[model samples]
Target: MKPALKHFFDSMGAYFGRPGEESLEQLYAEHPGWDAQRGRVAVYGDFVRGHVRGVLEKIFPLVRGAVGPEAWSALVEGYTLTRPARHHELNHLAESFPAFVADAAASRGLAAFVPALARFEWTDFAVFASEERAPERVERLTANPTLAVLEHPFQLCAYVRTKGARAEPEAGEELALLWRHPELLVTYYVEATPSALLVLKMAVEGLAVPEVAAATGMPEAELRGAVERYSRDGLVLAPGGGHG
Candidate 1:
């Protein structure tokens, strides 16, 4: 694309926020010969915003419900203005929405709970969409790619499970485990105990079973059982037929 055309599109992307009619008029004046019908531009802008909102709604329904429509719309609009979707796949657009919410909450003085809610929702979405692979044995486990662990001040997983009944932010360390079920073909979430969280962290860090056992001070047999259980449950990859 020519520099002029690139600039035009970038300028148009600004409309994804709250750009006024004057901005559109100015853009039309600056880029004459380009199709800039006000109605058409408005429709285009609505389409883009609607698409982005739909994706975010799917990924963060609880957040949307908690924030209400107006606030959610503003959040989405701000997100488009600041972090426009640059990926070829639209589904990947809201991958960073949780972080964006955190920043927005801080800057706007909105609810302190929104960020952790967003993170919990994004983790579920991410783990569901992540690619699945054959389980590898503990020693050969290089990466626990299919699972995600999120730590938050609010009990986000529990709150979400209760459909966001508790609106006020709670003060506590919450470890959320989002994973794809081994054979059910669906994603699931659970609150993790500290020991369970430690095991998962070790797995994600590519530690061997013995190494994990040593680090956690867990009995070797119990650690091996947990690893095997996760592998069978499809949360962890099966071991490859090789010594690590």
Candidate 2:
């Protein structure tokens, strides 16, 4: 908060946060003798940028693998310069990264799937970190509190599983159901069918099976079967006594 400290940080930001040739000159002009300390300032910038890239790499390993190292590094640097740290927690650094990737993918001429992949990866991390819990029982059908429905343009689940062995993903419009396991407290996902997604989306709004069937025009028997399957998989909170 002191003026001197604030000036130092601002100078550092100019060096790392801004691109082009004049950053160092601006830093040197701001504080005399910083020219002598350019090496130290460069090292400090590398250290901070390293931490940002490391956290993003951990959060979006799939995105990194898909884009390859050169593009990944450039993307990370772009993210660092554009989306400066806003949160106290390091993990929160990635909160805006998916949106960043969306813009970068377009301007940088990256693959179409890149944005979807980034979103999928971030959603996985978010579901893992969610504080919401599934109730033991539901009077009406209820979705898991941590459940997130993601509709992606590629087979993200399988693509992430392959770990980038495949150069590109299989292209298709798909729905993925991401949630934290109530008992294990780990994130899990399943590619879902349109009907199943519809049921779960309705259930998230507190619709009972019958109500969902009526609203969607699905047969009650079929809706009940789907509800039972979802309940067994912990996508829907089950009834107290049983899934009756």
Candidate 3:
């Protein structure tokens, strides 16, 4: 590209990468050589920022509600300025948002559980949108392709169900399993027992029920029963006769 054209595009990039009049003024001061149409350019910048904020709000509505209006506004603006969306599709834009939220949580006075909540919400959306499919049958126990094991310090399942009415999560250590419903094509989560999580985890690690029983010192029949129960819910993909 010619120097003049390259400079113009570079200046516009700096301006559009951040929202607010302050960023615009900085751009003008830094790029005095270029005289782009300020008003027309500002409109486009505003649209990009607005669209990014709107998509994030839709994806993390509970996070917005928990933070309240003023904080939520600042949060989205800060996120846009720091991590501009780069994906061709906006659906993947918030892929790093949970980590971003975790980094900002303490400084923003957000509750301890907020980061985990964000992760759970993202996982829920991801699993629902995933193209992966569970196999029709397996010779042995197998973990569902869409299974997600979530462990956090809050009762996030109930909190999400309340739609932020339960803004403050009840304090507790919780482990939950989330997955896409094979037939229903929706996300579902259930509080997991240690045995249930262990069974699935072992299956994912390519261990059969007998191996898990031997390693954990549990009876093989008991472990097999657990696998059969989970198979009924499609959490475990067992053989043809194993699925209830």
For each of the candidates, the C-alpha root-mean-square deviation to the true structure, in angstroms, is: 4.3, 4.2, 3.8
How far off is residue 243 in model 3, in Å? 12
Q: Pick the candidate with the highest TM-score.
A: 3
Q: What lDDT score goes with residue 131 in model 3?
A: 86
Model 2 misplaced stretches (Cα beyond 4 Å): 1-9, 18-28, 32-44, 205-225, 241-244
Q: Is candidate 2 or candidate 3 better by TM-score?
A: 3
Give the per-residue lDDT of model 2 (tens digit) for 139-238.
Answer: 7667788988898788888887777678888998888989987777778788897766766776767667776777878899988888777766777666
**Model 3, residue 79: displacement in angstroms?**
0.7
Off by over 4 Å in 3: 1-13, 28-37, 205-229, 241-244
Q: Give residue 159's error in model 1 in angstroms.
A: 1.0
Count clashing pairs, candidate 1: 7
lDDT of 3 by residue, 1-244 (tens): 9997887667666666687789888877877765878887688888777778878887898988888899888778767766456677787777788888899999998878889988988888898888888776677677788988899999888888788796498989998888886666788788898877887887778787676788889998888788777776777776674322
Angstrom error of the Cα, residue 242, model 1: value is: 17
Report the lDDT tens digits of candidate 1 across residue range 1-244: 9998788777776666655677667767777787757898877777777778788988888989888889888898788777456677788889888888988897766687788888888878778778865353445543345677788887676677788788765667887777876556567777776545555665667677777778768898987777666655555555553222
The positional error of residue 223 in candidate 3, measured at the CA in angstroms, is 6.7
Candidate 1 vs 2: which has more TM-score: 2
- Which residue pairs collide, candidate 3? none
